[model samples]
Target: MIAVVQRVYEASVKVDGEIIGSIGNGLLVFLCVENRDTDDKVTYMSEKILNLRIFEDNNGKMSKSLQDINGDMLIISQFTLAGDCSKGRRPDFTEAAKPDAAKETYNKFIEDVSSKINGNTAIGIFGADMKVSLINDGPVTMIIKR
Candidate 1:
């Protein structure tokens, strides 16, 4: 599993001009599932992100975790994160998990996050064409894999 987490003031996902998921003052998680991933990877990725210290603390330091700040999360599925560009002008999706398997992996990851964050996690449709928008806070972004 792989995640591209961004600290955001707000974020939302739209499908067919209808808002499906949204979050505020939290992290926007762009996730990808690879052919080699398992539930263990989901567990590790979930824990790592929830405890990641990207937000600022009262002391003006980047020391607050999502759980510490009671923040929300917006998750989006993006298999393209696993794209391979080493040999061609067009990126290859060979490393990405097959859709059905990837969707299940994505669901499991979301479930893990939901349990820890008290169901404050919002998610885009697994295989839908989504339009994502966000106001990136500090422009802070991280790519994590397990």
Candidate 2:
């Protein structure tokens, strides 16, 4: 599993000109599931993104977690995150899980995060051609993998 997490002041996802998911003042998560990914990886990534201390506190230090700030989260399925470019100019996606399997893992991750955060978690549709927009807070982004 791999996740590109960005702290954002606001974020939204659109599919075919219709807004599917959006969030305010939280994290935007672009996730990918590799062939080897399991439910455990989903759980770990969800927890890590939620608990990361990347939000600013009263002292202007990045000391607050999503729970601490009562922030929101937008999760998007991004199979391209598994693109392999080591060999040539054209990226390869053989490492990425098949759509059927990847959607299952993506749904599991959304379920896990929703169970933890309740109403604050939003998600993009799996396998959709999604257009995502965000204002990255502090441009604070992290690439997490397992």
Candidate 3:
């Protein structure tokens, strides 16, 4: 499992000129499921992203977790995260999970986070052509993998 998490003031996803999911004062997550990913990996990655202390506190220190600030979450499936371009001119996606398996894990991840955050969680369609927009707060981004 891999996730590119970005702190954002606002974010949204659009499909076919229609807005699908959006959020405010939250984290925008681009996630990818690898062939070797397990249920345990999903659980761990969700927990880590949720509790990451990247948000700032009153003293202007990055000490607040998303849970502490009650922030929203926008999760999107991006299989290209598993793409490897180290060898050839073309990128290889051999490590990416098959569509069926990837969707299952993606749903599990969304379910896990939604269960924790309730109405604050938003998601892009699993296999749709999604257009995502966001105002990246602090330009703070993290690449999390397990």
Q: Cα deviation of 135 in candidate 3 (Å)?
A: 0.1
**Count of backbone clashes, every candidate in sequence:** 0, 0, 0
Worst 10 residues of 1 by lDDT: 112-121
Candidate 3 off by > 4 Å:
none
* Tens digits of per-residue lDDT for model 1, 98-145: 999999999999999998993378999998999999999998999997
Write down the lDDT of every candidate, Cα atoms only.
Answer: 0.93, 0.92, 0.95
lDDT of 2 by residue, 77-134 (tens): 9999999999989999999999999999999999899988733888898988999999
- The positional error of residue 118 in candidate 3, measured at the CA in angstroms, is 6.1
Query: Each candidate's TM vs. the true structure?
Result: 0.97, 0.97, 0.98
Candidate 3: RMSD over Cα atoms? 0.9
Model with the higher lDDT, candidate 2 or 3:
3
Off by over 4 Å in 1: none
Off by over 4 Å in 2: none
Answer with 1 or 3, whichever has the higher TM-score: 3
Winner on lDDT between 1 and 3 is 3
